[model samples]
Target: MNWTVISDNWLFFLVGAYPYGPLGGLLLTLLLAVGAGILATLLGIGWGLSLTLTSGHIHRLLQSVCEVLRAIPVLLLMFWCFFLLPIVFGIDVPGVLTVIAALALVSGAYLAYAMAAGIAAVPAGQWEAAQASGLSQRQTLRWVVLPQALRIVQPSFVNQWVTLVKDTSLAYIVGVAEFTFVANQVNSREQVYPLEVFGFIALVYLLLCSAVQALGQRLLVKPS
Candidate 1:
């Protein structure tokens, strides 16, 4: 099925108009996923902690908001931010930035819930031991609790991250030339080789996801 088309345009598929146009393609996909995932990881820490640490209305409110974010689709959030922000706030949000924001906002909520669960999974004795050792509450969480909790949640975080990477294809709907977008563009012109082109697309996604999953499994291995 005309494999040369794939072989010929591999660079474009990987990098997209780079060195000549806007930055995009698989590189952009990874960038978006990494940027969004880091943002989510940091924010999730706060949101998640509020679940277990905070109380009263503040806790309920944070929980509600995170739940709402989790309920909404990423594409809807992207549309809201990309279109409404500029028109309502008089801000011109870049397309790539909007995708990152949307992905982070939604996925971060899940990460927050995962993080809270991870913290809960740590035995009560560990908390007591830290307290008996005279570590302050903040110090206990910062130095003792979070590291272990992070390790527990690492696999879940990696899963979310890989999903975010695949979701970057949505950027194409708004004109960002991400991996899927580039593939679609190429396919439209050389319509005869859909299988060869898209087959490569699937392979790229499989490799990226598999590598991430393997990394997570490696982290699960106990240290000697």
Candidate 2:
């Protein structure tokens, strides 16, 4: 309705006070999502390998850790990282970094399950063949199992990334000033264009999520 509010604050929505000061808004949101996604992916891969490759106590410990992490809410994780860690550790961690840390831990736990499912999807025959070919377990995993697992789980990984992008909105909880935070700020200041402000950001999120879906489809297609 009130297009003027959107017209005035679009830059703030896209990149709040970038050159002028700290980065915020959609750009910062993307940056945080990307950082967390990368870290989570690496953590997931390591955890997944441990889950699939190890046995007895190591496997049970990792499984319990994943379960515990998964059971905890992301909001609670962020609160602990931002508010509790400082008091406990007596170290000053930046809000943005704390948000990323929380996101990565939560995302990593979920993606670890995805990675485990991917590893399990690998054919038993493949493992038998790898073992018969004089390869050790680690060698077979590195050379045979992981490659197939990664390919099988590409779409799932992309879906997790999309989820991560949306999850970055929670960064607003810790005063991280992401896209949602900027939109809320605009609404609070203008008091007249809540629909316009929120609608615009919703469209942005739709486009970003759609782009990620398209990328997943493209990557899934086999080359001729």
Candidate 3:
């Protein structure tokens, strides 16, 4: 309950020794989460849009891939990529890279489902109107349908971002040296106050997630 400990170690929690060395702690966590989420969103949008436009065979394949990825646990995915990827592929990937890849795969599958739902909810008339206006399929998607669908799914997308932020904690399992990892290291070193370190980590996560949710709400209301 002593706030002084947190005040004293706030820099460590935020960036570890990143200014003088490699990045670690909350900054690393946010970087991993945001980078993975952005890559996942791109992949998801492509697959989701393909599902709307492609033949049954392609749709089935995409659906199955998403299902498989969604079914796997994040921790398992991270462990598999961390250990097996190097051995099986002869690629010497770092733990942090593996964690980011695992998260991106998982996030892409979930986002595909969300985006598919959003696209499906768009009216058929919109498509017809775009066609009548002499727009190509790509043009319609870029300028019309996607814009509307994205707006409709803004709330759900924001929720997914929040989930991704929290899920960054799982990166600790793969030794990514993120916020949670740093806290655990601190806890191990200061064994007399393990609870205090973990409690502060929890508070940091809560604050970050809350800030994202608030920002999402503000973006929803502000004229775009």
Candidate 1: tens digits of C-alpha lDDT, residues 1-224: 56999878888898999989988788988888789878987788788887889999988998999999999988889998888988899999899999998998898899999999989988888889999999988888887788788888887888887888788888875788999999998999888999998899999999988887787667542433
Q: Which residue pairs of candidate 3 clash?
A: none
**Model 1: worst 10 consecutive residues (lDDT sum):** 215-224
lDDT of 2 at 70: 91
Error of 1 at 32 (Å): 1.1
lDDT of 1 at 67: 93
User: What TM value does model 3 have?
Assistant: 0.90
lDDT of 2 by residue, 48-67 (tens): 88888789998999999999
The C-alpha lDDT values of all candidates are: 0.86, 0.87, 0.82
Which digits, one per residue and each the tens of the lDDT, describe model 3 over residues 1-224? Answer: 55666677788888977889778999999999889878877877887888778778888998999999999998999988887878999878788788778888888888888788888888999989999999998998888788777777778777877888888889877777799887877777666777678788878889999988888777642326
Residue 99 of model 1: what lDDT?
93
Runs of candidate 2 exceeding 4 Å displacement:
218-224
Q: Where does the lowest 10-residue lDDT sum fall in candidate 3?
A: 215-224
